[model samples]
Target: MTFQSVFRWFGRRGQSTVHQVDQDGQKEFTFRAVALGLIIGCLLCFTNLYFGLQTGWISMMSLQSALIGYLMSKFLPTPITAQENIVLQTTAVATGTMPLAAGFVGILPALGLLEEDRDGTPPVHLSWIASVGWSCAVAFFGVFLSPPIRKQVIIEEQLAFPSGTATAQLISVLHELPPPDTTLRQRRGYTELDTEETLNDELSPVEPTELERLHEAAKPEPEGWSSLTWSFLASGIMTLGAYFFPVIFSVPLFGNYLAKQWLWTFTPSLSYIGQGIIMGFPTTLSMNLGMLVGWGILSPISKHAGWAPGPVGDMTSGARGWILWTSLAIMCSDSLVSLGPVISEIVYKKLLRRSISLEDEEDKEDKEVEPDDRLVPMKWVIWGLSGSVVFGTILVWMVFGNEGIKPWATLVGFVMGGLLSVLGVRALGETDLNPVSGLGKISQLLFAWIQPGNVVANIIAGGVAEAGAQQAGDLMQDLKTGHLIRASPRAQFYGQLIGSFLSIIVTTTAYTLYNRAYQIPGPSFPAPTAYVWLGLARLLRDGDLPEKSNVFMLAFGLFFGLVSAIKTYASQRQRWYAKWIPSGVAFAIGFLNTPSFSIARLIGGVVEYIYYRQVGKENGGIRLIIIASGFVLGEGVVSVISLILRTFGVGVASCWGCAHGMCGGCPS
Candidate 1:
């Protein structure tokens, strides 16, 4: 069947709904609308990249893009005048590209030891061709892998697709706004909603049931606009200020102190939760507590000091530590966790819930599924996994373990890393396994066994660790969006592929330039902690746990799991407590990472909460959300660009004169 016919079969391709009528009183999904959204998405992506390079907040891309997209729709005339179309496409691009970009730029160059041909050039480190080629290959694999996982996480587990939901919410609201009415009524002024209905009536078929459903669906839901607006703006101001004036403007208290005291901190402090919230005492306390757990309690005290907890460490060490290790564990564990839920959904629904769908289907046989169809066959998942492994192998081959490291050697590393990851996942399943500790142990072993310059070996090991952890967290979230929207696995896969491939190219070029301009540290920056892990492993081989090592992670994990179970149970009995508990946990996690991060989370949360409490409107809430999106995209791109610069010896911090300028004013 033709693409148009296929879409029509899905009930998605039809005349524009009454809520989507424009000034011309026309109604139908048009190419113009889709094109408009694509254009906005592209522009927002570029703007985000520009700002990310200029500043250091990597996560600002989503917020920035959303804000910009909303503003554009509000002010400019587009083929698709609805808010939902604009925001959804824009955020899809921004959110999907971030990690792919960051990982490509940071990991590829570091692994390849790619250096520029400058005066007294650092002996031809990594080849550009190899790095880029490897990136494309990896992109292809990630594109394929990310989608299936996303579906499993989203469709099966039914977790919140927070970011996607935020974007979709914005777009849906905008789509529903009544179009401007032109024809004057005989009795009075022109009517607004009637104009929209009149336009919609001409284009749509006479399906009474569908029309009723559409009308009911079009009704606006209550939203928290004012609170969201203030919080978004406040968070943006705090983040921007911290990025520009980190040292001088210290994020009020703890984040600054942590950055100052620590040798490496991931993500800056201004990006944390408690940055500038004088009124958010509960939020502040939660975040600070989280910081104490993540950094002081976890990073320093746990066995995984090999990888610093936050963004900076990930950047500094090429993520030789926990960042990678934990990510891999998360991925595998989540996949395992999601399996049960997904099977249940398919079986129970297929066997039982068929009557509801079957009766509907009887009226319409040969119906087509949309590209956004969330349900996926198991076959595609198997293909995705095979493809992921193949691409992962290729990634290790060309870019990372490039310095004459044997393929066999790298495979060994992968095996070791994978085994450790599995162990960590298993432990975390039943009990909390302080994943970093497991990562530290494995990294320590490799450090002792694999010499420096064995880039391929290290890269493979690193990939296993990182992917594992990231997959664990990401699988559920992506899957949640898939379940809600029913986005096709292929579409999701390709979307990620497009994102990853493009990001890799962007990352490589930007980082190369940044590294060249700055007289920063060489390709051989210290992996002090990584080596420390190596030493520890040797001691373990000789038989002895470090005197200061804490093995209480399992206990902690169990305790937290119990707490989570209790909260989940309580939430069923008292919905208010459920929301509050989750909010509190979120706040704590934010604080644990960086004060700035915590601050941003709190702002987003409060904005959402307050909007729900007052005015019962959605437009303002969506607009504010878009504003947050703008900031997120803007900062994320800038940071990605900055990383590229650093890779080339052009110190982004130095080039920008951050030591004395706004960037240097960080409290820590």
Candidate 2:
């Protein structure tokens, strides 16, 4: 199938299954499948944990798992069925996502760094058990919530679960039987030469005949694997060299550097650039606009008004505090407004007395008696939810009771998390985006109101809500994939459960090890997401309100957020003018981190745009995406390896901050 056809398949809504029958009946959940799935899932889980903490983004493992599984299946003595592949992908994705529960890892450790002994409160040191328990509780709650969400959103509402649909198509294509006498290469649109002379003549470096050149020109350009490999190697070598060589010899433009006099910072990060390419131009542009407003406009104005705490160039100083407050206000308002349509739809369907349409009624009746072997029983889901609530309640109280959080409050947090999960799932189903930060902010606000001046309570409560909602949305998306491929939902559910358990163990260990090796929110790590959460928690706990000018900025931000949301909503109705509205979250994200990171990402987006214009979307754009993905993965692996070396005291002088002169007294 063409790339365009696959793209179209993602957005189309109809029956879940594209194939009339399962290619391999009831072959899922085999030992080989489970073992391979577990291995792949654990690898990805570790990688995601490492990457997400370094950057604010986690790589989705569905496509990776599917591709890897397909290739691995070739070596098995018995044929690897599509159903088994579905189970494998589901397991890998679930495990990979579980580490996101530690999204709070960055924040929590940063809180430790920010703590002072003179304040009389103990330093924030979450035990390994507490970390594991909390992560598992939140993630499992999401898993339990997935089944009902799948039925409502995927089955009844027929929402476009884009990633899930694409994954399903990929599995179908992989498992499809080729026509007789057709080789795999032939099936994929490559012709086999009858002899070595034909192959060598076509590929000869010496002057080729016109026919040979034309034949070579007609052949598809070597892409996908070849492009990905070269890009991965190039990015990896560059990043590794920059990290190590900068100490021995400095290259002015190769490493992260700052020019405080000119109020400019440069961070040459392959990972950030890759993220920019993936996120596209609109998001990158929105982020740059935010940087302009916060650092360019607001910082100077605050400095002039004597509201700034330090020089405008110092991001760590209080010059950017107003920007944080204003951005939070904007993000909160935008998140709520974005939910209006989904809320309205739910209310109309549940409360209105309108009779069901005849066709819909018939469809519902057919759905009730459909002969589907893959359906996960509703009772299992209920039981799973009940067990999770019971265990989660006990764990939360056990882990957090010493921190002054009441058991009742933890329960309230869980309830709020479940409700928020419903919203998160709905949003993801329709738009393929989960408002995780928004949901977390809502929880933070609610808990802040309930128990003022309690930072521990606020963070923990908010973490539960955010983690649960995110996991729920992620799992429901996986279920959508299973549904489309006719994979047994019960088996998929089991796979998710096992994968989640493994994730909790693996991620918790990784977090503890990494934190022990490096200080978060410090010069080396610079956990940006943690900084935002820490800032908000401190503001709430210290009873500090936004300053007068900040309050004004907050109001303006809210107005801008609302306007953006309205434009986005209108754009969904095909309004041309409304389509130009930028994403509020992207803008807010720019303020959450240093300007250099946003600038690097914008550079990536610009390159992508130029590529699109020059080479068109079909041919070169797809190759660029593969190359970008390789760059991200390669950089992530090297970063993790460097961290591990640091943990073992190998080349300890060559830390992340050494290049930027943040590591004082390190060997020069």
Candidate 3:
């Protein structure tokens, strides 16, 4: 099929059997496929735990899983079909992200961190089994929530879920028909007589037979020397180098003094730049604006004014802690207010009973013919939502009965979760950014009022929204991948359901093992994301917060957040400068982290812009995306390896220089 035809398949839900059409009679939802996915997913689960605790973000390596699955499938009785491959990737992505959705590195660990922070406060630790139950209960509903979201976002509006789209395209390329006789590569430069072993040794490391040369030349690009592969390797090498020589790429935006005081350094993170390339320029720009405001503008002011009185970057008593509340306020206000348009439209449709038709009769017919078997049944949604809510409520009441989380409050959190899932899915679709952190903070803010002064209640409430948003975002993105590849939505749904259950055990086990080995929320793990959540939780409840200007900061943030969201909606409606409007979620993320992260992302955006401009927008864009995905995968996989190495005591050296004070002393 032509390239356009391949992408056109993204909108072709009516056919619904693209798997059969494309995969040479290969079946989907195969036993081996799922088994492979589970195996890989179980193994891949560790990477995210490493990433989340260190970077406070998770990068889904669906492409890496796809590539790895392809390589591994060769040893099986029969090579897995493309549909099966999608299942493998789906399962792996699902399993890998479970830590994120379940809050293993965030809310759960924050509980431990908070306990440690408080003197004489009894520690509240959930049994591992209870952790599994709560995590699964909170996350499984999103799997059920995926089908409708898929129909709306992936099929109807067709927002570019970048990671998903790239995954689909990669799977398509892998399963595409073999090259025609005397393929394009042969026409590019090579000939039957040419043997280049002497000239460029890497191109032909060993002398190959005529058939081998023909086969190599028939492929579009040699597998051994793919530009994307090299890009992946280069990124990984850079990451390793940075790990060893840490301070080199941590470039100070201001002088070393300010860089030490305010973390305004360009972090040595190619992973984030790859994230920026995927996120595109607009959201990254908003993140930079946030970094400037939170770190550049407010960080210094807060410290100098004594609004925050602890050491720098202290979540409990430092500027970082103080700024977190304002950040939460802005994100909560912005996200909640941003929902006005969506809510209004829903209400308008309900009240007026207006069914403004699809783009045309073709879409109308597509919708009408969209098979029930292909869609996630509403029964599943009802059952999943109800089942998960009941399970979660029971768990909450049983565990947190004394913590002031009544069953009714638990139900409210679930309801709030459902509402925030809409916002989360929207963000994921538009920017490939899941605002689950913001969603969690919003939950905390609401519950701070509902069950005042109850920190545990606030944390659990936030988890409800966090898990829901994370799963909602994850499943929708995974479904988007299946949608493009003509894999069965029903099959993908089953895969996610299975993965969710597995994640409950697999990811929980991984974290429990890691936490036992090395205490989390320590200097090494930090659990920065959880720190932010905990900081918000404490700020909302602590009496000392009133003594500082943090509340005033939060109030100011709320005001500005409302204005920003209002201006954003008004501008979009009035055909004003909507694109220029800074994203509240992105800004909040900036406040949550330091400048190094956002600056790295901004650089990635700039790099992507240059590529889009220099290389034409069509084929080059796709190529860049595929390569950029490699960049992300490379660094992430390397980081995971580095963590494992550290566990083994080989890669223990840290903080090569003392200029920025990330390391108390220079290791070198």
Candidate 4:
């Protein structure tokens, strides 16, 4: 679509009838589907908690959950409708993404003790119930804010919501029966009367009978079932084999040996490759560029200039600390600039009472739709928002006030969270990025100014804002998927609510267990994001800016970020310039992670690009996505299992220390 046409489509407020509606009106929000979703959601939440602590990134489980849910329905005595599968996936996404909001999983645990050097100082202890309560309240507050913007963003704005779109496609394909070749139809007990001629005759300007609808629904399984099943098994076995080589057999080459010795970073992770494929070329390329700049150039320059200590125990780890600060500068600036148009539009339309556009009489007719198409009642939305505010206020007071945070400051933070959530959702809608860390930094600066010298208040307020924004952006993406598939908004909302509650409980518990097993910021669990948050909070609280050289680097990063943001914004209008503008956030993320991971991701993106060119984008390239999803699912499941086994001191990797280049035999 042309830019103007696409813009108009997004700006048009109306319900969509893009997909085929279910004729049977079957049970979509059933007890069975929800139970299955909850089970899968909890599993995903646990794994995400573990993985996020390990890698500083959370894996997307929507596609995996959809495939598993669909496979389960197929093997069961009674099959679920496609709508039911969508609901299941939605719930799974809600829970799977919740780890992003949990303080322990993301930031809280890395704070460690307020006074670690003191003889009897206790560790930073956040009560499980308080964590769960605050997270749920903030997440629900985000959910409550989503319905009002659903029409503007999803229907009118037509955001891609990339993951959600992929899940919807998976649901459609898995639920569809094989195309009716005459032979195949006949074998499935279809009569000659069920042919196209008879079908047309039965539907000639008259309502089809129930029997006709039943006949339509009675088809064989999808044509690609064999390919999907075989691919899934093959990928799983491959992942299992790869997992054993480096871990069990002490094979250096299969792990990070090549990277350590030669700097040829190649991660043997199919899951990372899949993620790269999903992230696409622009993001992966930007990340690689960041890695090159941060480690290849900046680190060496800093060491030569006597600004950084020479070659530490872990060079990458030390360099990452500098990169983290640089990234914060870039992310904060880019996020604020990117949010300009969205914030302006919201203010103009809502607060200023200005008409967004002039609607013609014919346009009014086109916009007319049934009330049944609406997802949720306005009354429910109001009540939910009100309840969230009251409960959120109480939770904030009870949780933070006990630690000497002022009630007014807590209230201000809650209000700021709601405002930031609007920006968060808009950013996600526009760019498929949630600037949580940037939002947190912004919140921290704001709260530091409001409540100076109170580190507890600063951290708590910032956490609340970040958590709210992250959850809000995530839920809106889920809502977009629901809108696309014609799922009930009310049903999706309830699923989200249930999923969020379960996720808070499950992830918090998992975090506690994992923390006890392997202390965070130690050798195994780096918790890099948490470290960043803790460092930032301390810096703001103590008014300790970086040294002169580091400040120059930060300024350089800020300038680069501003230029990148401008180019990106300009490229939207001038599509020809798009290839020249890289994603700043992707670059920042690249610096935050190991170089090997980014290299693997880039390779995956290259593979995907070549495959797309060969197959053509319109010629059912979704099959490739399904295969990638299989690889991700296989590796992720195995990784989680490995971690669980290691928790009990069973099946620990023989090369664990060596793989990380900590052993004497390995290169530093």
Candidate 5:
């Protein structure tokens, strides 16, 4: 059958003998696929952390994982199945954390940076109590917001989850059991190719493919309905209890609750931990600066000329307003620009294209299938909204009611946060569609609105804001994965909640140790580049533009936005771009990084291109790239684990310690 025919099979739910139509006949769940995904996931995560520690960009993992995953697919004993392949790859991609809220707070303290107590505690000596508090808060807020965000982005828009897409390919490759004809290679420039020899026999559920089955089974059912309830319940409990808790302990609790309150108020003041180590100053600066430039200058210019920058609001609220306007602009640009191709493709294939005449053999399946063409139902939206309100209430009470914010502000924040996610996905290319940053900006604006020294309002707003933005991108990606693979949105949301909750315990313990013992000095001190940028924006909003220097910042912001658009487009069109180069390069290069580092990345890219070009060669060029990429990723994550452990004053005799001893140097 032709490629178009195969896709038609995927879009349908239960036509084949199997409960689900494998996107390709080759696609199915299996142990091999899960193992492969797990191994790759670990490698990607480790490598990302290593590089994050070294170069400071989250997308680095995406580039390297794509290249390696592509290579690994080449050497499978059976022909690699495309669906499983995408799943695995996307999993690896999402596994790479960015500048999320808790990540920054936890990571910085672990590295012996950031004065934890706000008094005189050494930067390395952060409180475990505080770490736990923050982690729990992040998990609480992050998990709840995921489903609503998922609903708004993936369900509402039907946008492709870029990260999820990559992951689906990865998983699909692993699960496809009745291998295709491996010996064949494609002829050049052919629009279609012959299918590999049919499976010698009909395949059955086998033990080898159990992992994929388990993963599928593990997915949230009822479309995240239960998780939404849990979020609501959790928010209610936390909000009322905030008044009784200590300020430090309550900070995370309230902050997390408010994560969904207002999109702009969700970002926090101290959200530098994750990005600080993962991204260079230039990229981070530019992203933040874009918001400022758009808000502070672009919005005003438009307003002066009798035009509003999108539909968000007025842009004259200083730098804060500028950020809001820019955010709206970017979001609008991304959504409007991307929807056409995506919709056309879906409409053509799912509706018109599949109806083309088919042979009797293909018709056999169609004859047995249900004719319903409906997408996921609307019950999910109700579930998402109900959950958001519940969670937002809890967050508000915890932060605003207890710490210092008024109840009214908390309510406003929650509403704003959900709106942010809706707009974020509809506009910005934020696949995760989080509202924390927007909420935080809103809180900041509120501070200006309410006499400027409402520290409680500012603090609570900041916490929620950080969490919202922290989880925004990832949320979008997860939703996208759910959308494409026919995974339940509710299930994906629940899964995220489970992961985030567990992460609290894992990250809290790790972070506590990292803060107390393993402080590195000099070049190793992680820079709070994004924070600096935020501060600068804040200063500008305070009516003190840096005069001539502001021009450079604006230029950088424009450059960053353009590159982000290009990167987004490339990721959608070409699978290889995400696999090897990652979107990180554009951001990282904008900084004054050491020349050698850039050269090394360049060499890595060249090596990847060479491997990709020779996929059909005798030695199997693609396999070489995957194995090498695996090693690189493995080495990177491993090194970070070692260093973090060392920072905790753990014994150096372990394997990790040995690596650190060898590679350890003054931080750059």
Candidate 6:
């Protein structure tokens, strides 16, 4: 079937129901919406877990869920309003985050890997009931934390929760506003959203304005929708082509020999390009720069100098092993340092009973707060947070108390999770990325000090932070959607709670079933991030690290911290100069992944720059963001397709052919 036919099929199904509005008027929350949200959310939850195990990444699914909700709304018994649509997508997003939040794809699996000598045996220490209850309680507390910070970030600070904003726009355009072909927008005098000046980190400074402004921003012309449709289809096709015909991704630089050794393949993955667009120029450039410095320069030198004992591509004793410490150092230090002040400020204001907004804002709207009736009351937060913290701590202590995690330590973790959640929200607001894993790692580091070499304590502590940060970030993003649509915070919060509750039972069952079917860390299902978690645990337990690396790691960490500090300072004092500084976290990510991936990200960054220069969005042209969204969705589609294909034994999914020279076992 052609792409046009596919678009037409969706278009035919995506229309709003004429009977949607009754005389009493449609409600913002409904049984039909919640039911669909649960159904869709459960599917996405399983897929996310599967994807995370394979690729060490999990994507937020609000946009995709929203898209699906749009197409499926026609089948619902009662039609959903745009506000109700937020509830549906919010539920789906919350459910989908559970694998990572509950540690099925990270800490819990890592514990098993640590015990089974990487052979994928289940952890004897784990109890199914305890884990489920604890995970539920932990994720439960995260929902409460979002309400306290909603006004500060969304209203006064005006942080751009990009994915939330994008999803909000999508819902408004699809359900709330008139169709793009109509004259209603002109009649209402709704103007297009003007994107503000981007921060150094690519955060667009947009206010949480009225519902109409969001509609204007998201509503695309007919041609724009066509562009979005085509970009999405093309990206999916390209992903498939790259997989089947490796030649598409095997473009070489500086001849086959050097290119192969240097990992210089120009794999033009549209997914990476879409990421680059969302991640922005500075961050993507830093990733490429790190790839060059780490792989292009350091790897060759380390091998010849006998600093690394394994083969070039070997992860354990090669450049990958030694360099990761430095990467971890830079990432950890920068994340903490960059986020500390904001957390401190939030705390400082809370203590003083002072308003949290910065002193520079002039707009009356900036000081406005959502009515108390629409907001989540403090009583709910108190009962919810305390109840869950106490519940989660008891269960966690019961499960791992024998392993040296005292109940006090568990409480500390829950408390720390509440604090670190701010980091996740701030990062998501700015970058459309939540550094949950990073937050988790930091928690692990703290527990290393608190409990001192108890790997169980470290993992559980990390899990709490991971769960809290992810769920908190997810809620805030949904609330951003609610903010745009005039949905009640209390209603959305309850919808989020329903999803979180569902996730515990659904995700745990999915993981258990998948484990019985295959070796988790084995070839078919390499829970890659689990290995990172395992490594940290080993380092804590046995200090099993390579020699001659501490000095390098320390030096790099200090350098990264210094530069990050400068960047933070510059962002406030020297705005122009801040753009010139590389993001330490992004740059350090080079050591975390393959060389070719960074190069792909660089291609994306360059494409975005070129797009702005040439097309210019001159006088409200086709939406570039729609194309970016398409690329992301298309990539997700291919990932699911790829997973299914692999399940049926499509191919080994290996790269036998390098950009320069094909290996002897390659197809050619």
| lDDT for each candidate structure | 0.37, 0.63, 0.66, 0.60, 0.38, 0.66
Clashing pairs in 4: 10-156, 10-157
Tens digits of lDDT, candidate 2, 65-130: 765655445445454677778777888888877766646445466446455643235666777988
For TM-score, the strongest prediction is 2
How well does candidate 2 score on lDDT at residue 41?
79
Clashing pairs in 2: none
The residue-by-residue lDDT of candidate 3 on 20-138, one tens digit each, is: 32334557776666667776676556657766776576666676577566645654445667788888889877887888888887878877765644622455667787777677667
What ranges in model 1 sit over 4 Å off?
A: 1-77, 81-91, 94-130, 145-166, 177-246, 249-286, 293-368, 371-392, 401-496, 513-546, 552-554, 567-575, 582-619, 633-668
Model 6 agreement with the true structure over 386-500: per-residue lDDT tens digits? 9889888887777766564788888898888987887789766654556676688888878888788667677778888778888888889888877766667776887788999
Q: Residue 43 of model 1: what lDDT? A: 41
- What is candidate 6's TM-score against the reference? 0.76
Q: lDDT of model 4 at residue 245?
A: 42
Question: How high is each candidate's TM-score?
Answer: 0.53, 0.81, 0.76, 0.79, 0.50, 0.76
Best by lDDT: 6
List candidate 4 segments past 4 Å from native. 1-24, 59-64, 113-123, 127-130, 155-266, 310-317, 347-357, 360-374, 396-401, 549-553, 574-580, 618-620, 651-653, 656-660, 663-668
Alpha carbon lDDT at 566, candidate 1 = 53
Candidate 5 to truth, TM: 0.50
Model 6 CA lDDT for position 322: 65
Report the number of clashing residue pairs per model: 119, 0, 0, 2, 94, 1
TM-score of predicted structure 4: 0.79
